[model samples]
Target: MIMNPIPTQSSEIRVTPIPRMTQGGRWRVEAMRSYTSDLLLWFTRGQGRITVSGRTRGFGAHNAVFIPAGTMHGFEITSQVFGTAAFFPRSLNLAFPQEPLHLRIRDAAPQGDLTLILENLQRELDGDRPKKERAAENYAGLFSVWLDRAKLQYPQNERKSEKADQLVARYSTMIEEQFRSGRTVSEYAQALGITPTHLSRICNKSCGRSASALLADRILYEARRLLRETKLPVQQVAAQLGFTSAAYFSRAFQNHTGKTPSDFRRGA
Candidate 1:
């Protein structure tokens, strides 16, 4: 029997609280992964660490992070940390930053302005007003303006590029592009003119994870997303993700997520 699907909100833009993103201990959010849509994270309270583009930084209250689509990132959120995560679809072609930006807003005036913009954007997306999607897009543009202005105000201090950081950044960019091609960490190291051990060591120093773990985190994140969002069969999903076979994919996925592909697809 065919079951009617549950209703979902508009995909063009979505504003959700930080805690909701991790309601079920969603490891995908905390793992090294990228999204198809640009993400704007506004942290109004508490503090934690967030890694963007292979570099980890501490974040506190009144922080805004803009991650462009296809950039690898992850963050730690504690019970005290509360904020809004806004998702803007890449297809919208809005004026979001081209690179990942982490801005610490110190002044109360700008902080309040950001809060008001987010509230207004959230309202437009949630309401049933005429042309609400268009309205939300406009507000998103304003959000982009706020980002540009804030960037000007809080210019990032230029840090010298250490060898470890450069190597890890290159490795991360490669992983983002070719993770689905079934490339191993060793192969990546070879292409980068380094040994696997050196690569893993650098990755650990840069991102607090080994090279293999980072690669697996990205691949499995895509696997879970495909299983959850698409109607593709297990075998097809495995093939698409460059796994040798469905059984192997099932084992790897279960090892990572503790659930088989089919079971995870059924929301089990």
Candidate 2:
């Protein structure tokens, strides 16, 4: 008599882009690590348990959940699995809900609206990427409408913080995110309706640094990351850090750390 061995299923995942709603990528369960960058996940089909932000839930078909940026989490992948994930910038929450905490729908599934959003998202795969604002507006518009159907209470939200603090934190996260995109302090300040000085003051009081400092830090952090992690050469690294010339970036790096980028990378 011959006996059959049961095969153990590998619970991994991949992310497919659905147009402007997401920039494309794939993720496996093991790839879910403590990422400083934010991520969004949707399970189109499968059954498993996921622990996000420390809460575990059984998930499967017609069930969806979201994990905010900076959440330390992992999940169990079992049986036949399929899904899509979007790598959302932290700035996106400023335009809508706060992610894992906010618990906005990932896909409606059995719910009619969410299913439509997923369908529309799937259709996104075939076309050219739309302007981010248009795509964002579409997602925000449809999702907010669904949120309107939510019976959550505002009393808890009001008790969390005043609108000012909320806006400041959200915008700070946004600035840290998009500083490389060429927008300036004046632009961000004007958009936030405060003088640049006041915005700086708010940032200093809340985060112990000026808004400008935060932006520079993001740039420098990326510089250090590229310097140590990738094979891009010195001049290219300088350009990637938003410097026009390697000489200028060297000076800036020295000013910050008293060391040249080459020395830093060697030691790092």
Candidate 3:
């Protein structure tokens, strides 16, 4: 279920249960997408795999995943997972990590501290109080502090970096920067000084997906978002995303999402 939304004219912060966010469709939650606001997901129960910046890792209880704005990421959640997704607008200018972090909290004290902060944040938003926006901001600031302290308390273990991991990481970064350019996988592989087959091979090994599939997922997620959230015409949307023709955009979108742009927008 959704908690009360707290939003200012210029920014927004909302707390919602993890399972509720995926009530639409699996693709809505599993498809690779980025946001203009930073996202922190706190899982208190269950286990699943999440992919951040081309690296997939298993996550379980008390695992906190922080994704910076504009990072391509996605996660698979099971029915038993219990979590809160706190969205902090990057415009707030709070102290947030520049990179994605996966922190598995092993201690109960810190875990309780995070849960308390989130509870307060949700309460403030749900209550009918004066200056609620300011109170939400204050809680958001406290949440960031909690995150910093938790990071120090539960430092991530370093893993040996394989060549494939490094390569896929670089490719993921490039996709984040240029996904809207409508560049093909071959073109991207060429820019990285590798053949398309080599790039796809490494990507599959790194994330269990092909390079082309990864690129298309990122592109289609943006397309879906724009269609649902904006009033742009179909042709304009296609052009903005660098598609040569509206028909081509329509075909690609349908192939990926099983819905035409207009139909998706109408239903949305």
With a 3 Å backbone cut-off (N, CA, C), the pairs that clash in candidate 2 are: 15-26, 108-114
- 1-268, model 1: which lDDT tens digit per residue? 1121211223568888888886434564687787778988999999999988888899999999999877888898778999999888877888788988889899998999889999999999888999998899898888888888999999877688798898898898899999989988889999999999999998888878899999998888778767766788999999988899999999999998888988887872
Q: What lDDT would candidate 3 get against the real structure?
A: 0.85
Sequence-dependent TM-score of model 1: 0.88
Residue clash pairs of candidate 3: none
lDDT comparing candidate 2 with the true structure: 0.53
lDDT of 3 at 267: 78
| Model 2, position 127: C-alpha lDDT score | 47
Worst 10 residues of 2 by lDDT: 1-10
Q: Show where candidate 1 strays beyond 4 Å.
A: 1-11, 23-25, 262-267
Candidate order by TM-score, highest to lowest? Answer: 3, 1, 2
Using lDDT as the yardstick, the better of models 1 and 2 is 1
- Listed in order, each prediction's TM-score against the native is 0.88, 0.44, 0.89
lDDT of 2 by residue, 41-159 (tens): 55667676655432345666544455555454456554465565544344334343454533334334335665566556445534477664456436545644554444252112324
Can you tell me which runs of candidate 3 are displaced by over 4 Å? 1-10
Clashes of each: 0, 2, 0
